[model samples]
Target: MATFNVNDIRNDFPILSEKAYGKPLVYFDNAATSQKPKVVIDALVNYYMHDNANIHRGVHFLSQRASEAFDNVREKVRAFINASSEKEIIFVKGTTEAINLVAATYGRKNIGKGDEILISAMEHHSNIVPWQLLCEEKGAVLKVIPMNDKGELLLDKLNTLLTERTKLVSLVHVSNSLGTINPVKHIISLAHQKGIPVLIDGAQSTAHAPIDVQDLDADFFAFSGHKILGPTGVGCLYGKLPLLEEMPPYQGGGEMISSVTFEKTTYNEVPYKFEAGTPNIADVIALGTAIDYWNNLDRPGAVAWEEELLEYATSKISAIPGVRIIGTAEKKAGVLSFVIEGVNAMDAGMYLDTKGVAVRTGQHCTEPVMLRFGVPGTLRASFMFYNTKEEIDCLMENLGKAIQLLQPQTAL
Candidate 1:
């Protein structure tokens, strides 16, 4: 394997070189969204500049070009996750929309009164809320698999949770708040043994590592594009071909119809059936470019580098007095969520921002995680492959200043 160079990789991202607040920017909010590379940005610009047209059913030259580009992304996404076929990849707004699509279409259809949907305690709101709404509507029970103080799920309890009444199991591939990389494959295997289908929220996991949906044998997997260095307003849901063929469309509109008449209407095939109205053509095309960018990288090396960043930041933050690190799970990705003594996380976040250090603060959309840990919120410094140990140092430095500045205010 070639040596991974963070500096060279950083050059690909234009925003990494810029200054903010008259200070060199230290962006540690990768869990929120990743910065785009020049290639992806150029792909977006190139599409609008050259291939700007609505896709599918157009005989015009530009429309054909746009249609081909859009369709090609399905193949790219299929290959990216090692799915069996392009027909399984259904594009949506993001992971939120993707999960909601399943809950609405698959959950609504299959789940009924007294049915149980099992989800982990560490799930993001996107994973939790959709199922909650579905359960409310369907008269189904929503069950949770508990986690320990270290933020690791109790798999022993999972066996009890997987009862005959459990209809579907939805879980997060990685905990965004705690950075715990859940053993999704093992969980998926366990669920399959009981003849239960599993849905994985792969938003955080996909950016950190390569994913093989076939190997996991997940019934459905949802991920966001922006979290993986692609543009926002675009992501995909990868469902099994047979399952997708059986499920009803999430919406009705222009592109998703096979034939529409006064009496009856039919929907298109698996993927197109779910995608309605005009798609995010430009971003979807650019997402293909993002996949291309990720594919070109030394993935193993990149993942290792991110792990190193996580370790380096963890050590630095953990050594500080009066600061407590949350989510000390044995297996984790590139996230370090911590709380400082006598400091409001939001205030700490603001103080750090003035120094041009960008870190996510608060519950991070994981309110249950905060409540479980007995904290209002945390200051999270999430890393990516392009990030350096130097940036971690900058975060630690600014964090100390934030504590000093805010602790006094807390006393007052």
Candidate 2:
């Protein structure tokens, strides 16, 4: 087995040192949210402690410092995603807000009656609902790209779904419910071939994998900072420069306007045109620190380690007599969703919690995927780079006990 310096990584996260129910917290709920590193936390504290001021309008010392910090983070985000220009990156609350921003602005402008927007069967509610609302408002049609039993997108069907009238294709780069990593590069390429734009929901993939928006040729990409070890309420939307420049502003507020008159108003450039109001100034500054943390790590080595944990956990958990894994995609990240026969997913989650194991149980915000599989939901145990095979062992052992406890009751 390849060895990782788990102790050193654990030290970076302050919350990992604490006990959950008297046992050391084995955090498997990373798909939902990741714990903040000390660097990120300290950055947040330092921002408020020294440089708390509104940006872009003031020439005062604190405002200047605050504005510099906020603007610097934009450059950081631009580099992080390898966007062509910093102007293409717009700060929003999270992935949800980012998607809604595009739907309302880009969707409203481009989509009309008979226009189709394509989404995968495995999108989170955040990805799905925004487009649905757009379709409802614009009299546009929403088409779903179906997935196979293994939770992989049916690429063969993609051509049929994408026509000249297909205005947009929004897809998740990685499924939060399943670990399946979709071929977003191919998806983007296909959409571009049809002269259709693509929006990639990178909320799950951004944390586990490296991204290049230009390389993928994605029209729009959105991700949350919290999932990447930064604070919440600070996420980014990356749109192509031309597309961003063409779309109308998502909201009417301060900072998004270039000039305003009694009868006419002109919006700002790409990023500022989308970023309305004061924004999450402190969290945005801290997000740069989080990116720094990710940069410090051996990213490829970390991904390899995570893949090992996923494989080991899958093998161990799938061996249990009644356990059925929900997704068995060949190419996956650090998520493992499963259901044990004779145990309700909620009950299983509660049982694991009592044994000091943390797992998420529910639709995982992808109820359509759950309905397609004909299961209520799976107990989703997602891993991070800091997770260990030992932790997976403990989870597997506790899960077995949980199944044993429920089997007799369920049978009777």
Candidate 3:
């Protein structure tokens, strides 16, 4: 088997070489966001340099070119997740907006009072809050599936939770905080048997590895572009045709309309209907570049190298005294959440930062996860394909020093 080359692959990202605190930057916070590639960055610049114009309206050259680029990204995203058609893809601000869109449109339409919406304990706030709001507004009940100590969900509980009152089953594809890869295909199949639609929060999963909406047979799947190599303020929601067609428009404006006047206004078709207003023309166009970049790369090799980092880091970091690794699931990916016994997670985070290691600290938008583990928060070292084992060693070395400083002082 040909091994993935970490050094050569790192060169594609220019920001990786930058320094901080007089040390080379070791970004271990891929879950929050990933560094953009030259392709995506160049596309952003190229859009403004040439194809800068309002899309979908103007018949002029720049507008037509810009519109094609903007609309083409829908197809790119459609193919990216193996969605049935471009019509299934709706570009939103981020994962948060995508979730809210479904909750407002579909949940408001289908879910009703006394009905139940089931989620898991490991879900991020993006998944939880929207459902909570929908429940509150619709007078529905929000149910949670429990997880074991290893962060794996109790599938037995899920079967019980999928009751007659259950309107929808929404969960995370991968835990952002726990790094647990949920059995989404199995989960979806189980939900489908109950005739419950499933929505996957793919914000964390899409960037780390490959995903197929069809293979999972999910009713709706949401992901953030920023979590991958694409720009912030751009993300996608993939819903099955019937579900999207039935739901109301999320926001009403120019692009989303067919005809509008003082009287009743007609809306556009599926994807465009949910997508109102002018939209982020440039970033949406650039998103296709990010997709293209990921598609062009040796994806299997990239994923293999990421696993290598996870394995190497897990081995080294766990060996340290007072260092406890949370979420020891066998099927985890790209995240190493831990806490030093005596050290505050933020303290460890600040110390790690001084050493030029950028790792995320605290709840990571999954407060329920912290509560489940009975901790305040965790210091998370989330990896990416571009990260190196050498960086992992640096993190380990710095962590040892930080742990020592945080240790109780003894008589000298």
Counting clashing residue pairs in each candidate, in order, gives 0, 0, 0
Question: If scored against the real structure, what TM-score would every candidate get?
Answer: 0.98, 0.97, 0.98
The worst-scoring run of ten residues by lDDT in candidate 3 lies at 1-10
The digit string of per-residue lDDT tens for model 2 on 342-388 reads 78999999998987889999999999999988899999999998888
For candidate 2, the per-residue lDDT at 409 reads: 64
lDDT of each: 0.94, 0.91, 0.92
Using lDDT, give the best candidate's number. 1
Query: By the lDDT metric, which is better: model 2 or model 3?
Result: 3
Model 1 lDDT tens row, 1-412: 3467898899999999889889999999999999999999999999989999988878999999999999999999999999999999999999999999999999989999999999999999999999999999999999999999999999999889999999999999999999998999999999999999999999999999999999999999999999999999999999999999999999999889999999999998888999999999999999999999998898988998999999998899887888999999999998999988888999999998999999999999999999999999999999999999888888888888877777855434
lDDT of 3 by residue, 1-412 (tens): 2356778777878899999988999999999999998888999999999989998899999999999999889989999999999899999999999999999999999999999999999999889999999999989999999999999999999868999999999999989998999999999999999899999999999988899999999999999998899999999999999999999999988889999988889999988999888899889988899999888888999998898889999999879989889899989999999988878999989999999999999999989889889889999999999998889999999999998998776689
Give the RMSD in angstroms, all C-alphas superposed, for model 3.
Answer: 1.4
lDDT of 2: 0.91
- Candidate 3 at 20: error in angstroms? 0.5
Q: Model 2 TM-score?
A: 0.97
- Model 1 stretches astray by more than 4 angstroms: 408-412
Which rank order by lDDT, best down to worst?
1, 3, 2
